[model samples]
Target: MDEQTGSPDMATGSDRIAGDNIAAYASSAHSPTSESMMSGGSRNRKRSEVFATHESPYFFPAHQLYNVVSMDRSTSYTLKLAAKIDRGFFLASNDWTCYRRNYFQISACFFIPGLDTTQQPEVPCLLDYNGELLQVNRFLICIGAQIQNGDKAIELVQHTPKRDKGPQITPKRMPVRAGGDLSPGPTGLQPYVVTYERVQFKTATANNGKRRAAQQYYQVHVDLFAETDTGAQILVANLLSAPLVVRGRSPGHYADNEDDDAVAAAAAAAAGAGAPSGPGTSSSTPYPADERYPPASSSYRNDSISSSNGGDYSYYPNYGYNSSSYPYQSLGSASHMATQDYREDYHYNNNSGRHDSESYPASPLSPSGPHPHAYMTPQVQHGFSPAASGAASPDMYSPSGFPENGGGHYQYGSPTYPQYPQQHPQDQHHHYHQEGQQQLNGQYDSYNGGQQYDQETQDHATQLAGLRIHSPVSPSSPLIGSPTGVTPRRQSFSSALSSKKAGVGIAGDRSSIGSTRKTRSISMSGITKRAPSKTRTSRTVPATPTKEHHSNGGALGSIGGVLGGIGGLGGIGHGVKGLGISSDRIPENPMEDQQS
Candidate 1:
């Protein structure tokens, strides 16, 4: 110490040691401490000595440590992810079995252990391997195929970027009591759960070129990922469901590569053999187990095969049997023969009960043959059979048989049957003419017989004529007989005469007499008479003049008076003059002439 201040150096060294120990203690105190360690340390010390003594017990453990415990860096909590299907039990063995084109349900849940599940503890924030905060709250499910006893896996369906997005759970801040005040506690996020209620697979399990024993098995894979700044994904949590069996359209039947090969072979063979191939034929590609019998076509007549007689044999190739193998005769031999053969075959098949009743008629050769009621028409079903309808030949069966003028005419209306007699056209025409002439002669005789007058009718006619002559408007000629050549049963002539006599002295007498006289006149010179006045007027006539007698111009006055009388008589004279001249004539005013 005297050599290099030894005492002072020793003191400095001790103080440095103490200082390092104190620094170590302070550093250790400031370092992060676990809840359990902190609790143990607190038990060793007094409760009053703790920094947050007035804080609630709930705040002491979780709330007080909230700021100290970084959720992004904490390793105490771990996410336990799991995936399960609702209908995982198979009907046969309680194992999972999925059928193609069917729906199923899948559910996934991720939670932390050692937490009250009922409390719905939040899914704590996570950090990836790089220590970067993970910001993913959703997960996706993928359907993959795994071959039995195989090492490799095949993905059938994968999640898309945006369209196949998953569901997310939002974080919520829970309230808690700290000391004497209410404050926001740790964020609360319910368990991360998502459900795919109607998950369906359109494709069946594929063998992926593996052995038949190594059939396909399906699995549902759930993945959680966080997006990076470059839009890349970082895997966080992943889970896989149990293996399941996916079946094909036929239950319990698994299709493999061998079946596909067999189908391809059949299709190639059909194409080489010139068999019809289309949607219609492809639908029936599933052949039956029995190889001896071919699959039936949708119809008996396909569009490919045809006969020389405009018939259909298209179904022959469609029967899946070789057409050349059948024992059929040449179709060009005869149309009737070919039809008969077809009918026989149809009947044979029907008799064997191999075909349904609706396939064809009961019998094509029925006694009534194929009438309008059945499917086949009469023209196609049967030829002319004389025994059926008692006809001589095909010509005799003709609906219009033969013309009337022809020699061998078959008349339906003829009383005789089978044997129709021939008749001459000239004779028939003559017969019709005779009937018409007889009718005309009868009509003429009726007309002449009706015109003849009987004696009694003639006597009535004379009386009617005499009465007509006395009538003011006498008829031009004597009465003729009635059209029916009948005499009046009630003597209507007498009644007519009495009616004329009663009308003789009426005011219409002069016009009636003039009209009657004019009807017999040959000349048109007839005077029109004026009607008499209501008050009758009298007129005086002078004496006639003599040739030797003369008295103070009395003869001239008599001549003038005679002329005036003649002028006054013009109305009556003119009416008389309208008639033809007669040998005997009546004088006008006969009573006055006799007096003179």
Candidate 2:
């Protein structure tokens, strides 16, 4: 069904004729019953004067009415009607449209002019054309297309009610009061308020089952009629709502237009092409070959060789062996050559009964057979040949060659090679002992030199020891400072020697010779003695005499006295003692004294 009102061109001839009849009826003068009811006289009543005293029933303009009307659950209806009325009453307008599937309500208030401003302005009673008061119990509602300029009639389209058994036109009746009755009381003289409640439009406006134009418009026509005494219908008051623009059916109802066959065909093709094959089933079509990888040749697969004897195998064509510039003709020839070279250089001998053939079988490429010593042989021997022999041999110094040995080739440590002599354990011991003895003799020689140095040191030290002694006094001589001259006791030789060694003088005075005098003392014996101090008439016995004078005097007196006396040389002792006495008293020679 069309969503809008039908246009003039789209209407059939029958539809146009029907439209003309409707227009004529709507525009014609009031019917005989209506006129009689209004005038209470003849069926043809004269029209009212231009400035008539009585007021007429008419609809208010849309602008003068309240515009805030809405349908439940609808986003439409944002724009509403608003206008001024000449009667000074601001009434809601019914000059707008509504969408299909939406339930809406329309309300209009009727008022009689000439009413007191202080009293209720509502119409207390609806008067007929005859100036008689009448009650309007209900109104008839209908929907039809808007009249065009040249159109003589309005075309009404089919309408479906909301209920199965309800009238084909929704909201066919609208009661003026709740109980559909107007009692003869003050309450019954109520204000006239007409309302169409919860009205829904199921189908859009159309003509002859054709689609609607975008600008097509429809109107809701309301009519109130009263039954005369003769039972004729008299049109009392009627109103036409604003032009309505109805929309088409909702989008959810459009599924019925799709093509099921075409949809099924597309789904089948996609499934067959994209689905994977089952495990038990094989694909009928073989995989297409790609130009990127060419197929392998039969020779490449059959003659492929691998490095290991048994394992997972990967096949590749032998590339360089087939070329003429390659050194070895085949793999087997290369292996055999390496084996033969190893044998000849090392002197492999098969007489040891270890078969070389068993280790390395003959190569297919070398058809004559395996090399005689292609594999290792037990008892491999090595021999050294002189450079002048004119034979190709490995260099003895090379790391890979056999170790060099003198006396020709022989087993390790064998008697045949006698370059290194072997010694008995006892001889090794004796040899060690001789070396130790030589070291001891050297040590003894050094010790003897040290002894000679010590002897010289001791003799010098003895001379220094004598210098520390005081001149000895004779037993028959008087003490130098004694009062009675009672013959001073004689000190024994041992006591005199000890007194000198103890570093003390006979006069109880410490000698000027310090402890280090031993190191400074030098023996002047067997050497020319330094001349004695010049004799002075007033000889101040020199304090701490020169080291040379001290050594000569002390040595000659003390050591000579002891030696001479012990050797039975009394003259020598007397002369030495006199020299000691003279050195302290007068300068004289000990030899002169000895001669006297």
Candidate 3:
């Protein structure tokens, strides 16, 4: 049965001519019914024009492996050739198909032990299509190619000294290993496999009027395995290996006569009349991943969807939301463990009770600490604390000169302190009126302006006082004119009130707390008059040395800590105040923050 002509229909002379004409008609019908086919051919042509495009993979099975030039590793085992041909062509070529003059160029890259450098590796074996060994073609050798043997890997590339060679011995192509190959080791011992493929098609004039072009291609892929027997049958396990990656060319052959101008012109006219269409070669820039598809690495675990695990993770994205592209969730037991860490830190601050603030430790210059009123309120400044002598330096509060004392303590008697107000008649009357009022419950019953206000009204007054009030007048504005000792009166009043209302000390650590509160009060009094704000300090934890200490072992640990502490958390409490972040509210686990 003539399969290409589809089992010829049995008939008489009339039927036979009819069938022949129909066959010719059918063969001539090459209108490329599918757009995908045309597009693929156009794209392939474009690719061939822009960048050198290679042909489909070549196939030279095991029996023909050594028919070509071959070399033995350790003088015992022989590397075999096993080309995983592109399925497109493989399906087209069935068994028992004899091809002629089909020449192929092949070279083998093998791993050997004694190499000192990473770049100069060994290139073994060269052969032609007939399996006839070629003369030691030094030009085909690749040294300094990266190879890995278990833990020790090195780059032993072929160094082509200044000699006559076909091509420059630059890094020929990126080295790729077959599936299940181990990564390059630190030590300089690894092996690689290289293969080559070629193809050709010929036509001839015969008695028959039919025209035809014969096509033939070759692919040579290497299979390296450890073996105990000298027969080279037993496949030893691979300690370290990569895919069967080859770097070779796919040169298209124009028939000898076709290579000439007259032949080319005749061939063009024939193609114009009725020539077998070229295979719909894909024109799409074969995304490197698509250009070659290898068998899935056997070493890849079934559940590992990511390419990180030696698996193929190629995808084409559409504009709309794609569930597959979303941040992938692991499907294994370890998935939940990943979530625990995230949720731990996230929940911590969500419910933290104590106000979180950015502490500015007092300058350790004048025996005293940060000013009592450095912050808007004493409670708000609670987050700041002096570092231990061996720790990092105290905060930089005032960029100006420190007090004369090394402890940062300044006396009120210093000339820098403004004088207090005199006992004016209006103030006296207000003081008398305030004495006349009685405390309702434990809270104050009168406002700062001497108005007898209820509890709600007192709360409202305090809130209004904390609101940042802008000073329209510049420091050099006319508003700086005399307030008649008003500044002194204000200082005395604040001092008196802070002294009387120093509530229970937080953390029960009173040594610096009392002084800190006092310093906070004084600073607050000053900042309030100028840039009024209830600025609170955020509690800052000393950063753990994640990066430097655990860089090699745990990359994420250091990264997470560095992110969570200084930079990530530092910028949070800048503008807002009274953001109480108590310990109980914050989860103890730092990982709690990982949850969405």
lDDT winner: 1
Off by over 4 Å in 2: 1-97, 115-170, 173-192, 206-214, 226-231, 250-596
**Candidate 1 clash pair list:** 1-6, 122-189
Count of clashing residue pairs in every prediction? 2, 13, 101
Among these predictions, the greatest TM-score belongs to 1
Q: At residue 50, what lDDT does model 1 achieve?
A: 20
| Candidate 2 minimal-lDDT segment of 10 residues | 83-92
- Residues 1-596, candidate 2, lDDT per residue (tens digit)? 00000111212211112122221111111111112122222222222111011101111111101111112212111111110000101000111223343333332222212222113211123323233333322221111222211011232221112223222222221112111100011111111222222334445432201221123333333333322222222333322332233333532221121111112212211221112111001121111121011111111110001112111110000001111111111111101111011111111121122222211111111111112111110001111111101111111111111111111121111222122111111111111111222321221111111321121222332222101111111121111121210110111122223324433333223345554332212111111111111100010111112232233544333322321221111122232232121122111332332333
TM-score of each: 0.23, 0.20, 0.16
Report how far residue 403 has shifted in candidate 1, in Å.
Answer: 99
lDDT of 3 by residue, 184-246 (tens): 111101112221212111211011111122121111112232211111111111111111111
Q: Go through the candidates in order and give each one's C-alpha lDDT.
A: 0.21, 0.19, 0.17
Ranking by lDDT: 1, 2, 3
Tell how far residue 567 is off in model 2, in angstroms: 99
Error of model 2, residue 406, in angstroms: 99
Give the local distance difference test score of model 2: 0.19
Candidate 3: list runs displaced more than 4 Å. 1-104, 107-210, 213-226, 229-231, 234-596
